[model samples]
Target: MADEDNPDSGGTVIGYERELADITGAIDRYGTGAPSHIAIVAEPMAGRTTLVAEIRRIYGDRVNYLPLEFVIMDSTVLDCSTYEGDIILIDNCQFLSTRKIGGFDVLDMFLRTQITSKKLFITTWNIHSWQYLCSVMNLDAYFPTIVTLNRMDMPVLKQVILSRYKPGEIRFLDEGVAERSMFFSVIHSTMRLPFTSAEISVPWIKLNFTLMLRKLPRKKRVQISLEDVILEKINRIAYGNPGVALMLWDESLKDNAISLSAITETPFSISLDTNESFILSVILSMESLHAKDLAAIAGSEMDIDRVIYRLVQQRLVRDNAGYYSIEPFALGPVTDYLRKTRRLW
Candidate 1:
């Protein structure tokens, strides 16, 4: 079998070529007398984790990869006094600290170690946590190289998903929903400026909202195929998140086949008290946390069990055994809510 046909090899490397160049360039510079630490900033499904994997694939054992799957306690964090490769890659570095008083102690110690040690560090962070830390701890000053994984456009998103399969492998079954103009609708896009983290609103594409205002009966239907429509819907809902798009594709596909109507986007409606909102925001920043860590971040006053119960009841968070995190479909709504409530910086 061809390598491209294998799903394990599929990645958004094409979309991330520029970012890969920037990071690899930083690593190359590390060999010089002037070495620089780097940080990869992105949301959960934004492909930063994939980029980290690519880095590990390239450098092999030369780079030490430490992926933080859950919240890290103070006793477990490395002081950087010990041994490892000269290059260190830490994924999900947001777990380095929590959002409470004295919570940043571990992060402070880690930063101090990084400052004194000569090891080249490449770390990844959840964007919300990174922003909060930037404001509160001045984290921007620690890393000279910061790579924010920008959202991809429709074409790039399409390419990344399609590249996962061999040509003509999966059949696209059109369910005849071509009349709706979902792709070129007048929706405003949130465009983030590179490096500066500034954002602006731009119309994605201009066209009829739903084509529901047609006065006369159309003589012929639109020529758009079911494949295009499905891709467009996936792109719109995923909002340029490659990982999320892939997940939706897998969820929609049945027996190696897909239809335009098979893809459904779940809209989220959330209302929570201050403590619940705060705890949810912490989970978002840290990705996932156990009950103990959540309670630690929630502090003494907030009833951790009650807050978790409310969040779970609302379907805003999912409990995998003991680890708690925002539901995949609720990611957008939860982020918006936290941002609006000033819970996230």
Candidate 2:
């Protein structure tokens, strides 16, 4: 495959490029002198992991990736003096937020260790948690560098999709299949600015684009690139959630052409009338509650366990500290409905 044909090669590296450059510079500055830690703050789905992967690609074995997701240790585990490395990449530091053990504390401890030792620390966080910590705990002093992942524009999104298609990956679409206007429409709608997190958003964009292209009819189909259609839909409905968008597009592929109606009818589609109502109710009852609390709230009227599980799947709510709460953006409608109809007060 030509270098550009590889999506990873020509993908949306723009946003993180400068940040990574800065990190590399920081590492070079401190790699031999002293330990330095950098914190990367982005919205969920904004593309943190990909950026990290890119960093690893650039740094190779010199960087030690300590993904926080799999680490079951608490706040104090960060304090353990046994850890020693030249570079530390800690992804998903926001997980510490829910533990009431903010990433700041963990990062603080880690940085303290790095200062005396010889290691570079880099961490990623969900933007929401970053702001919350900044406000509640004055977390700004912890990191000298904070990189926020910006969403891709039309051109970048187009490049990202087209780059994924090898001449042989699909025998369908014509060359230069993505149209500018259409591409703009799709990316603008699908890719959100100041993303909730790149870790959540990038995979979503990549997956949705691929799934959408595959669904195109081989011949006598829409002349438009499957990339365009998927991007458009992703722009329209998916926004911060590429996962849901991809899954919905997969459903549309059953018939080879997806319509808004088909999208609404998909089983995973969040039905405003039915599912949204239940989610709103549960969220209103428990502000910042965990998954089980959501189950408990809905348990009296509906299948609490099932509802909480589905809510998590829908991304309408999330589990923090074994508790569940509605996503920040989703809180308004849920709160309004609860006040008016459910009498949540």
Candidate 3:
């Protein structure tokens, strides 16, 4: 059976079986003459584009693909109305609006078009942006079929990362650390007092395969391989985001060989002011943004250059030419800080 006929029949699902099913099921509903617009929502680098690509691959020319790379204008949206396809596919729908006063104008326009148009619209969104929009504009009511992606489990993430490779293509090497039980790690953090700043050193314990394997019976523990241990570490650090796990997988793969110690964490303490935190929040939602547009959303009070410099120096955000984004490995930590400080919606 075809993917449109059955979502599970699709290739390289990236563990999005449920989301793909929701989307294709909506498409099936459209075949019955009742159009159900779809929204694919996920965190940045969490496979939003991958999902859109899978849809296009399955549906072929029946889908019209329009991916927004930056903040869009009213004219761009005017052009969007002209695409005549059974399924209109869009990626990075977060770019349809900005976070400023007049920023949501284009999004509002697009939503209106979606409400009145007869064509089935299948759109992708950054999860943070969707949440913010939901809070402010009640965005959920617009799309009856909402496909939201979340973190995968260790087994699912392993399948996703290995799907790209042929069987036994990559070798997992044992480094003899499997027998060791406990390890000590130290990280530096800062606390800002009313008058002075101070650094604090903290020691923490990390659970490798030792703690987990110990819970199992002796026979089961003996059955686990270095491969299982390596993948588990990757999933733990990635926090179940397949994209980040794959990135870590690629980084750990050296000359087609991987070891337990090779997959490590990217450690950096994140401390930001109100303005800096807000900018980071914007980058998290938009995924990537140019300095000019970031300035527009950040407004006139902020010195965009300095903020960018600080974020870059701290390794929280990366500046590619001018398109700034949260560092792939830093996504989890950055998000936690933003949410804890209430900078993100």
Error in Å for residue 129 of model 2: 1.0
Q: What is candidate 3's lDDT per residue for 1-345, written digit by digit as tens?
A: 112224334575757776688788889879655578888888877777667777887888788888788889764554556676778888889999899999988988888888888889988999999989989999988988777777666667777777667899889998645333322212122233355222122323343455466568877774555676778778767766778888899898998889887777878699998888989999999999999999898788989888888999999999898899999999988987898999886
lDDT of 2 by residue, 204-316 (tens): 32334443444577763344444555455444443433323334445544434444334442123344445446555535332445554344434455666666666677766
Off by over 4 Å in 1: 1-12, 81-84, 176-222
TM-scores of all predicted structures: 0.86, 0.55, 0.84
lDDT of 1: 0.78
CA lDDT, candidate 1, residue 97: 87
After superposition, the stretches of candidate 3 with alpha carbons farther than 4 Å from their true spots are 1-10, 31-34, 76-81, 176-221
**Residue by residue across 1-345, what tens digits does model 1's lDDT show?**
112233256443767787889899999889766459999998877887678877877777788878888666674567554646788888899988887778888898888877777899999999989999999989988998888786666666777877768899999996746435563643445677798745444656655423333423565434544575677778677766667777888899998898877888787789898999988998888888889988887788889999999999999999999999888777777887998999986
| Clashes (N, CA, C under 3 Å) per candidate | 0, 25, 0
118: Cα error in model 1, Å: 1.7
What local distance difference test score does each model get?
0.78, 0.52, 0.77
Candidate numbers sorted by TM-score from highest down: 1, 3, 2
